[model samples]
Target: MNGRWAVGLVAGSGTPSERIAAELRRRIVAGELALGARVPSTRRITREWGVAMATATKVLNRLRDEGLVRAVPGVGTVVAGKPAPAAGRSREPQRVSPRASQRMAERMPEQAPEPASRREARPEAESTGARRVRAGGERDLTRERIVATALRVADQEGLTALSMRRVATDLGVATMSLYRHVPGKDDLLRLMMDVAFGEQPLPEPPASDWREGLETVARVQWRIYRRHPWLASTMSFTRPVLAPDAALHTERSIAVLAGRGLSWEEMAQASVALAAFVCGLAVHFEREAQAEQDSGLSAEEWMDRVEGEDHERLTADPERFPMFDAMNRGPEIDLGLEALFEFGMARMLDGIGLLIEQRGGEGGGLARGSANK
Candidate 1:
């Protein structure tokens, strides 16, 4: 396998199933398996590879995990196309700063034309009572208010339920009026993510410990996902939201690690890993919560069904699979999801700590390799 795919797979390796998963991923990325081609069925893979059914299932899941393949209901698993580049990739849409606006106008003189239309200003209405003296008129709706209301709706319902019409109805305004605030769904979602990031209470730097600082940030992010379950589904790593608050959080995270003496490359990798860990955990948590709500079955009850099958499998093979037998004997696995998150986060931080120490010994500066710094 190429180094890139090898590294990708190694990062996720922990079990035999995971190792098989890694190999499958390596194959897919290396183009050993073509795009749009169907992956081998579980039975075919099991017979061909001489692995168990569970292992084959895990392999397929791993491909799905990396977004390599997707199931088409009755059609089975087929490879997914690589995503196209985002429309805004080339020209980053910046907030209209005075300097930027001036530069644009200079470049395109036609855009500097006089204002073409005007709305008739409303005449001031006569005030009526003591209440009018005490209170101001209804606050004019702004972009912030529009985004806040949209976020609230997304929090209560999933992102799938959020729409321009729905938000307009909630705000007691005509649907066309919303266009004056937010142009479309994409614009609203971007603003909502920005507002959500703004809600986090970031600590002032030089944090006591880098790990602790990161953990705090991750926990705050977890809280956001817990409150707004749709967030996990909406967030995109490839097309990051460039809102000021979101950018500030990224800046803070990098600053926390700078104290550790890590190089720019190391810090960048660490940042990506930290984000993936939090997002991955949140996705699973949201999925489990949704499953419970949909089925009305507690987590324990769901585990019981899997445990029963595991028990039956153990009875059939006590000698051939000693590891499986031992696992069965151990305390019921809660998937160790919470513990896994902490453990993985700590391990990643520990690796960064070691790198920091190495860089410190070499008398290297934190900003030496970073572009943003």
Candidate 2:
């Protein structure tokens, strides 16, 4: 309940739920939490320890299971060894079937096993290698591992398929256990984005001049989008996630324009402008791949398949759409993503280079217009 408990709850050794249960057990045993005193509820534990409700529930369940605490009708979860039961209540302990006992043995493996008993059905994931590893006392889990695993899942399958359960399955751990590392998918995505941007770190300056710096940054970002197609769509310039590597990328872009005679605001605009351009074009990277995969045909191939007699006749008429007919003729005229990206990258940098030469990168951001009457 105190800040001291957070030491082991957040990052110290042992699982978060185990650490909490042990702490509460120690408190109750030592009279720090006396009999009849209400222990922290699942909601309270979730808030105090910054763990998920599932983790907190597990802690309370463990405490109740150890007879260190018990639940009352009106009262909340209280310390164990309380006064005699009320008149209407029975003191007899609830029965646990042999199969249930065996299941309990399988679940709470940290405790001693109960007597041999029947085994009922188990969930497919329950008896999995993940459970086995957890049962065997493997305890080296970290936030880095969780983030890395989630990134790998996103890389293989697109970001849409990257749920916490899938990552937990890949890592051979319970879905809730991931909450102990990352709060949720948004936090995990932030970490993943940071890691992705960090993957191809820019040079100290990454460019010699303004033109070269802008080009280099855009090219590097384009390459990353190709590597992880979903990355382009995960990012947003308007509402950027607070990732260190993402910030670093922007910093380097702005830094390259230093001494180019641009104001700080102008430098920021230049950097954001280039990044936004790359992201806009890069957005189509995943969509095209997914489209081709789903339809089993390339864009050109699909067009050919869907082309009708009218389309042929329309294209054959040079007088009606002369420029269109001529431009659409060559089979080699494949305006692929890579080609477009290179072409656009060159043109954008050219425009930026022209701006730098003309304005000397001076401030010209949105001249405040007079109010409309």
Instruction: State the C-alpha lDDT per candidate.
Output: 0.59, 0.66
In TM-score terms, candidate 1 sits at 0.56
In the range 1-373, model 1's lDDT, one tens digit per residue, is 3555544544564765667665665566567755544566555555555667666666764454334565432223555533223564321111234564465458543332122131011111123201111122123667777788788666643454467765654454556777887889898988887778778767665466666666677777777766666777777678776778766656667777775667688777777678777877777665665455344456778777787887777756978888778877788665556777766666665666667678673223332223231
Candidate 2: clashing pairs of residues = none
Q: How does each model score on TM-score?
A: 0.56, 0.58
TM-score top scorer: 2
Candidate 2, which ten residues in sequence have the lowest lDDT sum? Answer: 364-373
Q: Who wins the lDDT comparison? A: 2
Stretches > 4 Å off in candidate 2? 1-138, 298-320, 361-373
Error of 1 at 275 (Å): 1.6
| Residue range 285-333, candidate 2, lDDT tens digits | 7776555544545777877787666457778788997876776675646
